[model samples]
Target chain A: MNSTPNEQVPLADNSIIDLQEVSIFYSGKIAVDKVSFPIAKNKITSIIGPSGCGKSTLLRSLNRMNDFIPGVTVDGMVTYGGQNLHGSEVDPVEVRRCIGMVFQKPNPFPKSIYKNVAWGPGINGYKDSMDELVEQSLRQAALWEEVKDRLHESALSLSGGQQQRLCIARALAMAPDVLLMDEPCSALDPISTAHIEDLLFELKSRYTIVIVTHNMQQAARISDHTAFLETGKLIEFGVTDQIFTRPQNQRTEEYVTGRFG
Target chain B: MTTDTYQAVQASNINKRSTRWAEFLIQSGLGLCALVSIITTIAIIIILGKEGFSFFQHVSPAEFFLGTRWVPLLEPQSFGVLPLVWGTLLVTFGAAVIAIPIGLASAIYLSEYASDRVRSIVKPILELLAGIPTVVYGFFALTFITPLLKGIFPDIQVFNALSGAIVVGIMVLPMIATLSDNALSAVPQTLRQGAYALGATSYEVTTQVVVPAGLSGVMASFLLAISRAIGETMAVTLAAGATPNISLTFFESIQTMTAYIVQISLGDAPAGGIAYQTLFVVAGLLFVITLILNVLSQKILMRYQEVYD
Candidate 1:
C-alpha cells in the first residue's frame, strides 16, 4: 500500500468508503482480482474499463448485489464508515437500503410515476408526507418539470431517458448514503447521457457516487477520481485529471487513448 | 474461370433452389393444419345449430331455460335446465376454489425458488399429471376420495358434487401450475434485479413486482383452467350421480351438463327424438357459455397487460 505523490494528498481524509484488496469470484472463476481504492465523500468516482473487465462486478460488490447470484464469493474487506460491508453480521438488505443502485438499462417499475418514486420509501416504512417526498425526489432527479402534471401515469409511458431519470428518482426516495451507477447511460442517447452526466455533478454534492463506465470521456468529464481496470486487474488509481492527462501505467494510457482496450 | 469456382457457383444455385423449396413446403404444411382445425370447428357448429333448433321446437324456450327440473325420459318430462346449469356451476366453482390457491403457490415456488435440477424434475412430473386419463381419475375419485371423505364426515354421499369437484380440481391443477409458471418465469430478469436493488426482500420482489407484472398471463391460465373444469365429463359423470337437483349443498349428488349429455346418449332413445335432440341443445349451451367466458376474460387481461416490448 505504498502511497504515490497524488495518493499522499489530503483528499484521502475525505474517503467515505474504503476497499482493501477486494477480490470477487463467481463459481470459482475470478471476476475481480484484488482491487483496492478509496471512494471520496460526496464526490463522483468512476471506474472505466472495457467489456468483461470486472468493473461492474466491483461496483455491485460494494452493495452486496452479487449475493443474489448463485455461487458468488468475495475475499478481502470493503468498509463504509468503519463498518465491514461483507462481514458475517452485515445484512445485505440493509446494505442495499443504504446504497441504492441505477442499472445499465432503465428499469422503472411497471407502475405509476408517483408509485415508482414512492415504492422504496413506502416499503421501508416512510411515515411522513409521501406526496412531498415523491415530489422532492423527482425534482432532484430533474424529471418533475415534464411529468408533474401526470404523476399517476404509468412509468412505462415515459420516454427512455425520462424513465432512466425516474429510476434515479426512485433510488433517491430511499435517501441513501451512496449511489451506484452501472453504465446508467449506455442505453441512452447522447442528449440523455449529457442530462444524466449533469445530474451526477449536481447529485455528488449530496450523495457519494460511484459509477462504472466504458466511455473514457464520460469518466473524464464527470468524475473527480478515476480507477481504470483491465482484465479483472486494477491498472491505475488516481485523480481524474491526472489519470486522463498523465497515466503512469502503460495499459491505462493505451486504454484511455483508445489505442487498445 | 477455374473449374473449382465454376462448380462452387453451380452448387450454390442448387442449394438456394432446395432451400426455397423447403421453405414453401413448410409454409403449406402449416397452412393445411390450420385449415383442418377451422373446418372441423365449422362442421361442429353447424351440426349443433341444426339439432339445437329442432329441440327448441319440441320444447318451448321458456320451459327449457326456466324449468327447475331435468327429467326428459320419464312420464311428464320436465326439461327445465336450471338444475343442470346450477350443478355445472357448483362443480366448476368448487374446483376453482381448490385449484387456484394450490396451483398458484406451486407455480411461484417452482419458478422463483426451485433449483435447476429440482425444476427439471418437478416440471415433468406435473406434466405427467396432466397426461393421466380422465377415466382413471374418475375411478380414483369414486374409490379413494369418496371413501376418505366418508371417514371424515359420516353424512358424506358416495356420489356427491364435492368428490367430483375435487377430482376435477386435481385434473386442472397441472394446467394452472404449468401456465402460471411460464408467466412467472417470463417476467424479465431486469425487473427482479431492480426490486432487489431497491432493498426489497425476495418475497416482496415476487409478490409485488413479478406477480403484478405477469398478471395478464396468470389470469389467462386461470380462465383456461376454469374452462377445462366446466367441460370435464368422465370424472364428473362417475363421481357425481345423474340426478339434476338445484340444491346448494355440495354434499348432495348432482349431475353436470356433460354428465346429463352422457346419460341421455347412453339411454335407448329413438333417433331424432326430443331425448336425442337434447344432447345437441345442451352441448350448444355449454359451448356458448364457455365462449362468452373466454372472451370476457381476454378483455379483462388485455386491459392490464404491460407490454414489455
Candidate 2:
C-alpha cells in the first residue's frame, strides 16, 4: 500500500534540492516514509508537523547530517546540483559545507563571538581577510551592532536569544547554498523568535531555507511553501497560504485550526 | 468543614510528624558519616605537626630547604633535603614526558573514534593497568625494564631513576587515560554536531571543538595523575636506588622523598630520635604538596566548567 499520497505541490523551476521517494530508517524501523519534494531556490520552505512526525529526520537528510547517527540508513535519493549526496564518491563533510544547518538549541562553540563566526571558514582553509568575513557574516545575521564591540568575549556570555543569532551567523560564514534549521527559535523568547522571523524574510533573497517548526503560526508567517507531515508521511504540500488557510487534507485542516494534532 | 474530613487531616498530620522525626535521624546519621573523614584528617595533621615541630628544632628551615647535602642516617649528619626533592622532581618530569602524550592520545581514540563494541572491550582492559599492584610494577621495572635499559645504555645503573620513572609512568597511564576519556565523553553531543554541521572533519571536531570543550576536565586529570606519581612509594622505593644525590642524569641512581621515607621506616631509626623525627617532617611536606595539587585541580574544574542545557 502507498503510504504517501499523490498530493505533492508543483515542482519549482529553480529547485535547489530534490528528494525522490526518500525513506529514512533507524536500525530497520522506518522514521521517514517514501516522501518526495522539491526545495525551491531563494525561498523559505517550512516543514510543520506534530512531534515525532519525522520532520526533523527529513530535514537532516538534505545535507546527509543523518549519517552521523549510528544505525541510520537512507533509501532512495537526495540530489543537490545533479549530484547524489549519499553517493560513494561524495564526502559528507563537503556536502555539509554547501548545506549548513542550525540546531533546535543554540550550540555555539565555547569561543569568542568572532571565533565562533570565523571557525567554519577558517577550518575549511578560507584565505580571505578573516576580519571582513566575520563582520560581513555577523552583519548578515543582524547581530553585528550589538556584538561589534565585544567580539572577543565568549559566546556563552551572550543571552539565549543572542546565542541563537550567533549560531545563525556561524552557519552563514560557510556561505552555503542552502540553510537547514531544526526548530532554531524553539528555545528562544518571544522577542528573539520575532527577531529571527524577520531575519529569515531577509535571508530568502540569498539562500534556500528549509525549516522544521512545531509552531504553525511561524510556518504560516515566514514560509513561502509549507509541507504538512503526519506519522512519517507527507499529508499535503503547497503554497503556505493554501496549506494553512485552505488545506485539502482532513488532517492538515484539523491540525491548522487547532482541532487536533 | 465535615468532621470526617477533619479527622482524616489530623491523622495525616500525626503520620507526617513521625516521618519527619525519622528523616531528622537519618540526616544526622549521614552527617556523622561525613564528619568521620574530616575528624581523621584533622587528627593526622595534628600528629604530623607535633612531630615536625620537634624535627625543626634539630634542623634549621634554611638548611633543610637550601642545603645540598643529605646524610641523616650516616655520621656528621646533614639534614639538607635538596637532593631528595630534586630526585623526586626528576622522576616526575620524566614520567610526565612518557605518560601525558600517550594517555591523551588513547583518551581521544576511546572517546571519539572507537565504536561502542570496541570501546566496551578495550576500555576495561586499558583500565586494568591501574588495578595491578604497584609492588608487581616495581618487580617488573627491576626484572624487565632495567635489563632492557642496561643493554641500550651500558653505563645505566641497575637501580636507576630511568627505570623508576618508566614504571611510575606506566602505573599512572591508566588513570590519566580513564579520567580524560570520561571528560571528553561528557562533552555534549550537540557541540560535536554543531562542529560537524559546519563541515568539520572528525579530527577537526575532536581536536578543536571536543578537546577544547573538555579542556578543564582534561587538565584536572593530568594534575591528579601527577599528584599520584609524586605520592607513589612502593614502586619507586624498590626501583630507584637509595642514593641521595642531586643529579639530572636518568642513568644515575637517585632517591625520592617517598623512597627515603620507606628506607628510614624499615631501618632501625630508634623511636623519638632525630632520624625518626625526619620521617614526620618529610611526610608532612609530601602531604602539603599533594593537598595543593588536589585543590588546584578542583579550582580549575570549577572555574572553567562549561554549562550546557
Q: Per-residue CA lDDT of candidate 1, range B1-309, in tens?
A: 999999998887764434578888999999999999999999999999999998888899999999998988877888999998999999999999999999999999998899989999999999999999999999999999999989987897889999999999999999999999998898889899889888999899999999998888888889989988999999999998788999788888999999998888887566778888888999999999888778877875676554856
Candidate 2 Cα deviation (angstroms), residue A178? 0.3
Clashes of each: 1, 0
User: Native-vs-model 1 lDDT?
Assistant: 0.91
- Model 1 chain B: weakest 10-residue lDDT segment is B12-21
Chain A TM-score values, per prediction = 0.96, 0.95
Model 2 residue runs over 4 Å out of place are A1-10, B1-32, B306-309
> What is the C-alpha lDDT profile of model 2 across B1-309, one tens digit per residue?
899999998887764334577888999999999999999999989989999999899899998889899898879999998899888888888888888888999999999999999899989998898999999999999999999999999999889999999999999888889999998998999999999999999999999999999998899989999999999998987888889989879988999999999888997588889999888888898899999999999998886664543
Q: Evaluate model 2 with DockQ and give the value.
A: 0.81
Clashes of 2: 0
What is the per-residue lDDT of model 2 for residues A135-226, given as tens digits with 9 covering 90 to 100? 99999999999999999999999998899999999999999999999999999999999999999988888899999999999998888888
The residue-level lDDT of candidate 2 at A59 comes to 94
Q: Which residue runs of candidate 1 sit more than 4 Å off their true CA positions?
A: A1-8, B1-33, B295-306
